[model samples]
Target chain A: MVVRGCENRSVNALVVEKQKSRENLFLIGVPCEGILDWHKIVSEVGEAVTAVKEDGQNLMVETRDGYQLLERADFLHDSCKRCIHPNPMSADILIGEPLPEGDPNLARTTVENFETQTIEDRYAWFQKEAERCIRCYACRQACPMCYCEECFVDHIEPRWTESGATPAGMQGWHIVRAFHQTGRCTSCGACERACPMDIKMTYLTEKLNHDMRDKYNFEAGLDAQSQPPFAAVTLDDKNRFTVRGE
Target chain B: MNHILEKHTLQDLLQSWRQDYDVYLPQKMENFSHFMPLTETSVLVDGDPHNTRIPPKALFLPMNEALVKFTRFGGYEDAKHEIQSRIVFGIRPCDAQAVQLLDTSFIQEDNIDPLWSERREKTITIGLGCHEPCQTGFCTTVGYGPFDRADLDAMLTDLGETYLVETFSEAGEGCFLGLPVASEEIYNQALDIQRSAHDQMPVAFETENLKGKLEQNFKSDYWDTVSQSCLGCGVCTFLCPTCFCFDIVDETQRRERVRNWDSCMFRTYSLEASGHNPRPSRVERTRQRLSHKYVYWLDQVNQIGCTGCGRCVRYCPVGLDIRAMLRQAQTLPFEVSHAA
Candidate 1:
């Protein structure tokens, strides 16, 4: 088992080669931090790294380690200081740094501030910023976590979000984005970064992250062994975050 | 410092700049205004204080950008489109920041756009401060003024007699190395002119509770009332400097693939191949437009997407004022329901 950082290309390639040898292999890559110039990175990496196109998501690598499946490090929320899934679902070899301890105090303050603010104020500011949205969906395309075969915004059957600049439609789009992230979101702030209008969508995710941690004491993508909150029902689970009757 | 560039010197500088970088400046093409290649023309930088009808993103992202062209028979064909290194001159601060905002959206993520990154990396932004703020300009209200230097590589402020050039990035400083520069006295005078212009600007909007208000009144009747007259002509999106939404379509023209701009304001904008129209009503479409910017975008990104350039407000045929709508959203009353 080989564990290293800044060896993403070689690690990914090794994982792919090993995948050919076996049905199941677990490989991990580092979580991308800050703003990245992907074009520059891809250009710099050159043709040695061939991006394997899956159904929708593509895995780019230089060599396979031993895993059939490759997992890139993902953020739990926008405020997360380290990659929650730095280690693979089950790995023979782990690449990149281990998960770092996050400042729960910062999360608490942010969540409290978010809770205190009236929904009306948030809505109004959202409308003001959304009014500038051209509906380019750049935010949707840029998010790694936003992996749906077809997004609701693109749905034609009932048309969840109309194709125009109406206030309600814009609100619906935002509500849907937040709802989808729920417990599953690793806030990486990628969506906000991708918006041409400069809409700070990360704040919304951060607010939700605070709720998940404070109320449920749950952190997403932190442990591969644990079942996701929405995915399982257990009597032993804490109910502080849930409604009483439900 | 307002030093006049003789028409001849300006042309020579443009030619020289073109040798090292792709020079982009405002050009009058037929009747409309756009940023085109100094690739061909002599006088590229025109002194227009009013925001360009089109944003500078169009120069890089383009109204019709080819993502990946492929033939049905051939598996996957690589579209080796290369963006040359360039300098965009005479751009306004609002536009420069708009580009920076775009950078966050396109460059800072797990899935980065190769095309956008290439163009952005090679491009040098030269911001020109608005000496005379436009009647519709209100960028100052939303944390950006005409002379804001947050996103510029270099800034050019117009003094009465000459232009004051201030470099903000290494690239910006490199651009002005051998060029004729104004004296320090002139530079100070340009600063004075900028201060006065900022004070003279009148449009302002309170953004303190903006996000909250929009969230509270998501289902308000105000949207219907305000958007009733909207023709959905989509001029606002097209003309907006920061509106970066586009539609991708595959077209075979003489065996070559082509794509073009698609506006969300159009009824057909969201119609899918499966015949599902999520935002069926004009009202719903209008609501989506507002909420995406105000609520969703803010929730997803960190900053307000709108730069207050007022192009949407100015060009709407129905005179649908986004600013006024935001103001109304902030003040609208709604029934509070306890999530019981």
Candidate 2:
């Protein structure tokens, strides 16, 4: 298996969950740059684009009209813009030159930007982004952590959320989807890039990731053996939701 | 009914109809263009001649809608949602054509869906021809065009500071009744613009024997190779202008029978209640999606199902181009399948 930073983390997490045997796996790891946003390129170059050649940090785009030189960094997807890790942490074989580590503050700013807004403003922003959802589940399908045989949304007898594109239904899908990735997310930004509506949702998961980091001093999938806060049971645990006479 | 509508006067004319109809036009969303209702402060999106991120089909079929409302004691009633008359102005020709194609499925004499039929009846489409056709679209190859007038009530040709409006119906003519009739010289200039715009689009694929090739090669390894990178996401079908499959669900909490958009690309779409999926994997799902458009639609309607609007080509997560797929399908050796 070929593993980038996110894919490597996903594999480690899966191994911890007993979904795969690490002994049987041979992972070829590579340093990552980032995934480019196709919409950004199409928006700038228009659909007349015949071909795009990725040469380092520059994109030589051939359109029906003429040629265009586009800066690759300018067109990176939002989640990739704030990536903290670009190199696979654990692999059997490491390939290519390791890229420079991304700053943690960039990911922090994304969470902070959403968290700083008023509760109503936060809800409004969420509502605006969520309303564009077609209930396609493209995000779930894109995520490596989301490998459930039958998804909760697909269940009929005990419907967890409204089975429509109404406001409530859409909101439930977004919130619950992020919640499922609480300690499992590798911050790949594949979900955001996969969206047809181009709805920004990594912020929600990033917020959960921020909370996991802050409360439990935990980061998911750093190694093959480290258990995530949500997955492991600890003797010393803190809880604000459930009443406990400690 | 050819007339000249000055650029400055277009907004006021749109505003005047607000008293009677909900006028929809493509306007700027966060980054891309979207179909938004005209308000007093609405500014029309311009500069790029491309289709909106969302197709106009949303105006008619909608992503989801309540078909029936349930009462306290198991009694059910028609949803009876009031649909207002709407003017879908500046709809692209490809999108407009898609609606007309969908009418065959939704509005057949033997079987009629009330929700879709009612919405279709209430909306009027006015097409805005693409002066510079989008790079991804291949309407010409699919027997449609950048300036197709088959389903539009009125078609507009961009003439710099003005629009050359050609109305095909009484309702379309009524919208621009007061506009001055265009002269022969101006009409000829508009024709030149339309022709040049049409000339810009290259035929994406050879439709000749393409359907036969796909139908014959149902079990080819080509499906596996092509569908390898596909994330099995619904991005392609959901964004598609012509893909109109939906699933009905009984929402007990909402007390309504709602219809939500479904896609063949979904594993669950073909999944039977007995824990068996007819189209088991992404390969089969991808084959169904492409074949339905290329083979099935042609067999049913004698016309290609895809409008070649390019939403699937543009929004595909894996960057799977249907144009490229169809062109590659042209190379596969044709053979008769016993099942066929």
Candidate 3:
């Protein structure tokens, strides 16, 4: 059930192991940093693993250094922490520990509360920072939680948002980003981390995260089994959208 | 509301919680800020309501996360992501509400995102009420306030010298059950102070028939007029606490498949692989943005999609006042339609 130093061990081992075990097997591991590429990993061992599995359903490889498991749905999306299907749908052997608890490096302050002297001053500071955005979508591309088949930005029939680096376009982009991740975002920090312009995109998500927690006592991605707050409704759930009482 | 922690006793409480659940608190990084795991050295409480540049959403829905990785062929695999029981400390009310709102999108009947559902299941939230409301905060205007208590297992209000912790859920009560208990007199005093603080909050927005107003003004000339000065920078959306929309794309690295976050603002955001662009004009795109929040989200969720956190207002480069836009929408002489 174990192989070492196969040269193609990372890729080949899965196929080899599946053939011998005659059972559905899932491989979870990080690509070797920097040097590791998907093609090499697949070419070296992918074919061999597939040949051995019955119905060719037994062998599968989850790439991304084990982070794909965080997305428990289909393989169409990525995972922030581990493979989406780290646990076998129906298998005997399991791999890796469950995702750890607690926020890794969440900033505690609200971006609005940051002292900037005056509203005009704060706006100016943000303007300068936002002006640096190139509309590259690096933040979007880097996020693991974005799993829409057709994003609003790309929807042509109804055209939900625009596509450009202009301020309005950028506003459309960012607003949609924050709004989409509302209850679903796990706050993995990948978007801000991936932004080439370093636009501090996390500030938006953080603000929303704060709001969700404060208003609903709900935190996204905290549990796999519980329904999202927005998707499920209770009569007692505070309706922020409801008319306020004096 | 009145709970006493021996100067460092908060650390002990955090450690105890850590044993059973992952405990998170705000920590300062060189020049930036973040919430890290609570350790002996972690500072438990501080008085800065400044919205952290990073939302706790990553704890649930991470960027560049792996939903599933597969070989080129029909070989299938499943991700074994497990939900971790945890506690988020010092969560602001706006962010708290944002998570609640997010649930509406992710946990919906037809299309529930499994990853978000998992994280939402096991986590308990402990919110820290705003002791000093931020200048950009207009939660009161959007039917929220500096210290709104819609979503929190427990809430902590700063009372000058001590923290008045109120348990709103059984889980919140359990969080404080074994820890030190607060005196009733102190709790009453903290409540009194919180009431005063709530009353003193000046930032407000008028939401009277706001959704109806937005619907009527969907095609108003006001959009072009208001957006005329807009530079189209995404600061407003990127900074707003409640704006959430994203795109997903698949990429291949060394033959391994990958999916990543994509924004609607990009020229390619709407350009399908077939080369047709839906939102070709900036004006059309702008209209979509405003209407989605004011009109669409409200219509779908029966909730206005904004919390009035003012990150959008404060961060916008061109001073695109969302409040002003909404206000104008309110007064516009347009017919409201409920038809889909």
Candidate 4:
């Protein structure tokens, strides 16, 4: 399977969870600079888009309206903008020269921006975004970690969440979904990109990821052997973080 | 009657309807536009994104609606649905046509959805014709055009500083009855704009015998080829103007039976209670989605289900264009058989 940095991390997390055996998997790693947002490109070049040529740093777009040479750096997806890792951590074969590592501060800045908002303001923003959800579950489908046979939302007899597009249902789905990816998310930003409503979802998962890093000093999918924080067994140790490597 | 509405007074004209009707227009929500109520401060963003991300179909058939509210002691009553008379402003013609297509399904002989019917009855649609039709949109390819006014009460043609308003019904006439009538030359100019806009659109695919090919090639690998990149998500269907499949779930905790939009793209949509799914994978699901729009809609209504609004094409995560898929489908081999 061809995997990017985020996908490789997801595969490693899956391997640790006994979803797939690492021996049977042969991963081809492609170094990713960033994923260009088509949304941004459209906004930039509005009409008569005949052809778009992708390059290392510029997009030569041909349109009836006008020709535009868009800077690739400006159109990078919000998730890709703050990507901490562009090189696959574990892969049998590697391709191309790996790009320089992304700044950790950039990722921290995004979460901090959300965190710095007052509780009321944060909740208000969450309400505005969550209410717009049509309950399409594109976010779930796009996430590599969301490979459940039947999602918890679909469980009929013992329904975990409301299956409608109500405020309660939408909010529950978003919050629970982000929590589920606490130590497992690799910040691919596929969910945000997939959303038809353009709801900001990476913020929710990224916050959980930030907490996982801060509290336990654990980053998901650095290795196949390490369990996520939720799945890790500590033997009732006094220090929560001490049992990770031991 | 044809009248000219000056662009500067557009907000005043829209908000003035609020006294007699609830005015809903495409308003900016985040990056894209959404159909929202016209407030005092409502500022119109003209023809930027072409159309709203979610179609005005949502205004009629809400994503979630409570059908039956259960009472204590095992009793139940129909949920109260209060529908206000609304003027949906700036609706693209393709979407208005979609509502007309959906009317055949919802307002049928046996099953007349009162809620859907009520909303349709109350809502007065005012269309804004695309002078500069969106490039992504292929309304012309689907036997509809940028100025297709099959279901609108009134249609507006943008004329730079002024708009040529063409009213088709009494309701439409009432909205702009007091405005000054557009002259013959100005009206002719609007017609020229509409004609040019319609002519600008290139035919996306060959629709001739396209339905027949899809019907015959049900077992072919075209489904696999097209659906390979699909994530089995509902974005396309949910955002679609015409796709109207719903799931009714009884929320026991809430004591209500809620109807929410369901997509054929979902695995659970066709999942039978006996742990068997008729349409199993994304391959079959994709086939169902496309075939329903192309073959089944033709079989049932003698019209294509899609409006060519291009929401699905623009917003697909994998950038899978249905136009490209159908173009590929046009190449699929199927022996032509004449009806005896």
User: Which candidate leads in lDDT?
Assistant: 4
Highest DockQ scorer = 4
- In angstroms, how far off is A10's CA in candidate 3? 51
Ranking by TM-score: 4, 2, 3, 1
- Backbone clash pairs for candidate 4 read none
Task: Quantify all predictions' global Cα lDDT against the true fold.
Answer: 0.62, 0.88, 0.58, 0.90
Give me the overall lDDT of model 3: 0.58
lDDT by residue for model 1 over A94-190, one digit each (tens)?
A: 5555555444666566556656779998667667666655455656655545556567976656556643334554667877887776665655555
Q: Provide the RMSD of all predictions against the true structure, rounded to 1 decimal.
A: 24.9, 2.2, 26.3, 2.3
Stretches of candidate 4 off by over 4 Å are: A239-246, B338-340
Q: Worst 10-residue stretch by lDDT in candidate 4 chain B?
A: B331-340
Give TM-scores for every candidate, taking all chains together and pairing residue i with residue i. Answer: 0.55, 0.95, 0.56, 0.96
lDDT per residue as tens, model 4, A1-246: 998998898889899888999999999999898888877877788756778888768899888867889898999899999999989989999998888999999989889999999999999999999888988898999988888998988889998999988889999999998888889987888889888888998889889889989987888888898888787766764454466633
Looking at candidate 1, what is the lDDT of residue B67? 55
lDDT of 3 by residue, B45-139 (tens): 45555555455655665534445555667563544567778898877787788788878888999999888887888888888877666655677
Worst 10 residues of 3 chain A by lDDT: A69-78
Alpha-carbon error at A65 in model 2, in Å?
5.7
Off by over 4 Å in 1: A1-246, B1-8, B39-41, B179-184, B253-259, B272-274, B334-340
DockQ winner, 1 or 2:
2
Residue B51, model 1: Cα distance from true site in angstroms: 2.3
Query: At residue A14, what lDDT does model 3 achieve?
Result: 26
Model 1 global lDDT (CA atoms, 0 to 1) = 0.62
lDDT of 4 at B296: 93
State in Å the error of residue A82, model 3: 45
